[model samples]
Target: MCRTSILPSTVKAVKRGEAGSAGELRGDFDLSGDLGPLYANTGSGIFGRLEEAPRAGAAVPVGMALPGPATILANVRGDEVREYDIEILKVAPSSADGRDLVLSVTDPELLEETGGIVQGMSGSPILQNGKLVGAVTHVLLNNPEKGYGILIDHMLEAAGDGVD
Candidate 1:
């Protein structure tokens, strides 16, 4: 049997307004790196075991992801991870599959460069207060500046991390 990843080999890379051959706003994506074996695709996000050790970081509780200021680490440009400012607009504690945070891009530079959330940014980590909170999930089709995020807690749960 052939196994495949939740995310396709070709990442979605394009601005929303950019038209395709059929006059449709289709996006394209480039494969930057490998994420190893992804075990879960909760619809909101994907969870996987990495091939290499990850950087040191702290994992905060989902409750910490309140409506407030946050930042997302993304690589809009080739391999260069940059932190962009954002705001947590709302928290849906009861949401299933990790769509627990609503966020909007507030960084002037990010907005000017990517024109809000484009393709190839689905799994960018959303951080707040120097801790990992959630990840960017789906972008608002009408307004690229706004998007949904999956709480880190949900992701951890889906990954079978803490269950006894």
Candidate 2:
């Protein structure tokens, strides 16, 4: 397979809204880059011993990193506000082409408590369609609930991927 190497520093966090805003929060992530080899030892048979390496530059496509100082559009209860530091473990290809992306969150508690996805989970980078698809935008934060994602194309197109 392909072998890619990404530095840990590649990742960055995107904050949402101002601290004093009505709805404000922030999310952390590991930027896309050349990730080292990921072992695939199933222990099924002798062949399982084979160590598989990732493709070179296997990180999510360029321009996928969500911009900083993002706005979190989420509904909160009471006046209790909390922020979380999220780690993006993996970004892989999706079945669809340029239409859908697959993103894996490292924290299971967040997933279990919030179902599939949760609030403040938006703006998370998803990797699929061979490019930076978008970021998580919303979440149910309740039963049978999942999170929502927004296409990066529009954000990038509007922001121009450059800050003044």
Task: Compute each candidate's TM-score over C-alphas.
Answer: 0.73, 0.33
In model 1, how large is the Cα lDDT of residue 58? 54
Candidate 1, number of clashes: 4
Q: Which is the leading candidate under TM-score?
A: 1
lDDT of 1 by residue, 70-95 (tens): 99998765445789999999999788
**Candidate 2 Cα outliers beyond 4 Å, as residue runs:** 1-59, 62-110, 141-144, 161-164
What C-alpha lDDT does candidate 1 achieve relative to the native structure?
0.70
Where does model 1 exceed 4 Å of error?
1-35, 55-63, 161-164
Error of 2 at 117 (Å): 1.8
